[model samples]
Target: MSSPQFSFATTAEEVATAFSNEIKGKNVLITGTSLNGIGSETARVIAKHANLVVVTGYNEARLKATEDALKKENSSANIRRLVLDLSSLAAVRKAAAEVNSYSEPIHVLIHNAAAAIGPLNLTVDNLDSQLATAHIGPFLFTKLISPKLLAAGTSGYVPRVVWVSSGAHAFATGIDFDALRKPNKEGYQAMVAYAQAKSANVLMGIEISKRSKGRVNGYSLHPGVIYTNMNQKPESIAEMQAIGILDADGKPSTEKFEWKSIPQGAATTVAAAFDPSLNATPGAYLDDSTLANDKVGAHCLDAANAKKLWEVTEEIVGEEWVF
Candidate 1:
């Protein structure tokens, strides 16, 4: 399939304009939409086009701030906010049920929420925090809301689920299911755990596309190495400074690398969610606002691994999502 006309330089707002006519009455949902992150920016642009836009995050203040900001930016924008902590299964279930209660079928679901480079820990559900937040929680939420997506498809809307993965998935050799199932502090590393979770995100996209059998499309993408709050921890800043990625004042060192602007970073996500060219090619991995030619990783593309991960995820979430 041919890629969309968009390129790496395309901004989220431009992508929205390109699809505004078609998306005017669509229902879109996005997670992890804090004030200035990619999720929020994507939602901001989509809100201008979509009939209803649902923004979600774990922080109440940030969620409200985003909601207010979106309304402030476009007074006529139809927007809603919901609390969704991807680390908590209970919270995910409640949020999914609440979203399901809405009369409109969801036309697009963007899994833009993720936990990266956080301390190794376990959630109340006994799963690794990074894995739970980045994969398991979203997995359960997607399964719960899939019926809505299918319904939207039946009604002539192209329903899509976009997973915001990272190129970091290439850093991990493969997913250590045993370690993820029972984390051990002796060998835990934040980035490695994050990479594993990201690989799982890609695998979930592949599996969902296969399971949905074209009723709903699934996509995963590397949103580029944009500077975001998730990577602005004191430790992270110090590490980046050491590597010359950031300076002492916590700004990008342009000579070393050019970090993507927020809109540029969100362009691919916006494209993945609404690009008509991708409707025929579900489960595609995208980067720089285009379909990635290189493999994300061997394990990420393994059908057997994707199926196993899906089964284990269902067991961990304590729910069976029969498609």
Candidate 2:
């Protein structure tokens, strides 16, 4: 079948409705989910047709709220709540163990939460806050959950891992494994740190495909700039102002970017996970709900860097991913 044409104006519900067959009977999981972000909206759409939808976050109340909201939207929707804080390796390990206990394959996994536009703060793992939340934590979680993803793939479902990246990835041109090992607080710049983390997110799409040999497809996307909770922080706004994204009044400047609504922001992510057309290009990146590899930085697409990231990540996480 020819790929359905979608654009920036499309909504997650539209794509979910269009690809309801792909979603039917599928069990999907999304991280960083809450009512205030794209993850919940992505989960909402998937829950409309998916057999089971697992929503995760660090906050138990927020996960419960997300569960209530999804159920309100579709009473028959099957929703499971998991507490996952991507910035914490300890939390990642605990969550990974919980997911394994269920013993069900996750047909689609979306790494949608991120810690962007923040001051440098190191986690217990000694990784920078932005890098740990946006990349390393998700990287480790994906590795730990590979058994579930592989089970789905072996069962004839084309399992996928989707990383929601950002256009701000252009702020960095390369990976800094040393910085991840030893965060340079004195020289730390939020944009650069966040950019490198997002860049790692893009590379996951590239590397996971090669590692899994197409059995578990990987995809990355830019969920168009939106005013989510990530943007509501004063520090986040200050960082955006430094880059001319927001005005002195903290409003999105129309000249520099066209911000998307929450639903529109999640459209590309939904398409990345459920669009059958994406199966043809396992590790491709998407923008505005369309395949747009040219939109990402060349550094993020480097095959050598992708491989290096996979290796360094295992060491940083202190675990081996044999698959």
Candidate 3:
């Protein structure tokens, strides 16, 4: 099947046009935004439409700058910043706790911050950095803030959590159950690790949605590859170049692929967060801004795996979840 291309060229204003005054009072939080990435643009767009926009990243200065920029666009916009390092469980937990302090309910939580690397690395907790940042940290963060989301709106409908996953997840043959803890000397297959992390993200979303049972929505989306930093990390770029995946100028090697502009890359995330029509399908995989029935590998879609991961994550974080 031929894959369709989507552009992220849409500006923040263009994407925000889809939303209406109904979204005006909604509280929205976006993770992984920095000055130059898609997250910054996501923050820009959310700040325009949502009542409150909580922007988060590891860089304090950049976070403040993005917050300021958003404020300039919408002075009435309630914009805040949280410096979070998703690779660290301690930081993630702290960030979650801080997010819970807000009295207002969060209408939408976008898990858009994730990592792609060409080398195997470990976090402070000795877990795979990619996996922790992409799956575990975001998972815990969502669980922590779910109550706030539930409190924001009616009991029947709470906030939605959208996991910004990647189509690369289709490449994970199966999850490495023990590999997450044990160091594999296989010399860092960036593609495999990225795929595994993304698959886990999808599974995590499904599990969270199942637990919510339509009270809230959860989505795993592959927002067609935009030429964003997340997809072109330094190590991965070197690895791709060595393998002929990229050309001399570092462009994707003549592969039939969709490269979205920043706004377009963020389209599905914004839609999932604010689109009321999607309320019915609380747990679904989204691709190219559409509901996807693309059958993931058995393990990627396995309820058993999701539960195991959840249980193990709780053990790692050493806390009881309120959500």
**Model 2 regions lying over 4 Å from their true place:** none
lDDT of each model, Cα atoms only? Answer: 0.85, 0.89, 0.75
| Model 2 Cα lDDT, one tens digit per residue, 207-266 | 898888778899999999888888878779998887777888988877788989999999
Of the candidates shown, which would achieve the greatest lDDT relative to the real structure? Answer: 2
> Among all windows of ten consecutive residues in candidate 2, which has the lowest summed lDDT?
149-158
Local distance difference test, candidate 3 = 0.75
lDDT of 1 by residue, 123-146 (tens): 887778889888989998998888
Tell me how many clashing residue pairs each candidate has: 0, 0, 8
Q: After superposition, how far is residue 39 of candidate 2 from its true place, in Å?
A: 0.8
In model 3, the runs with Cα more than 4 Å from the true position are 1-15, 242-245, 252-254, 320-322
RMSD of each: 2.0, 1.2, 3.7
TM-score of each: 0.94, 0.97, 0.89
Which pairs of residues collide in candidate 2? none
TM-score, predicted candidate 1 vs. hidden true structure: 0.94
Give the Å error, residue 3, model 3: 22
